[model samples]
Target: MSCPICGAEQQTKYRPFCSKRCSDLDLAKWLNGSYAIPAEAAAEEEEWNEADRSSTEPRH
Candidate 1:
């Protein structure tokens, strides 16, 4: 199998990735929201906004 990130041959240690650098790069993508699905993220954001608005309203 080949590395998904760089297309290099897969290494035994990394399994799917060729090296630590590529593995770390993939992780950084996740940590920084590079892998976020747009529809899900938008729904989550809308939920947060609605919650914030409800919290700020004066109580009856």
Candidate 2:
């Protein structure tokens, strides 16, 4: 298999990445939001509104 980050041959320790550097780079990309799963804004907005309402409500 090849590295997803650099297209180099994948190493045993890093099956999807060639080395620690590539692995770290991929992690950084994820942490910085370079990659994302698409979401529908309408659904997300509804969820957010529900969460906000619940948070503001008095608890028993």
Cα RMSD, each candidate: 3.7, 5.5
Q: Best-fitting candidate, measured by TM-score?
A: 2
How displaced is residue 34 in candidate 1, in Å?
Answer: 0.5
lDDT of 2 by residue, 15-54 (tens): 7899999999999999999999887998989999999999
TM-scores of the candidates are 0.63, 0.67
Instruction: Report the C-alpha lDDT of model 1 over 1-60, residue by residue, as the tens digit.
Output: 999999999999998999999999999999998997656687899999999999999999
Instruction: Return the clash pairs for model 2, or none.
Output: none
lDDT score for candidate 1 against the true structure = 0.93
Task: Give model 2's TM-score versus the native structure.
Answer: 0.67
Per model, how many backbone clashes are there? 0, 0
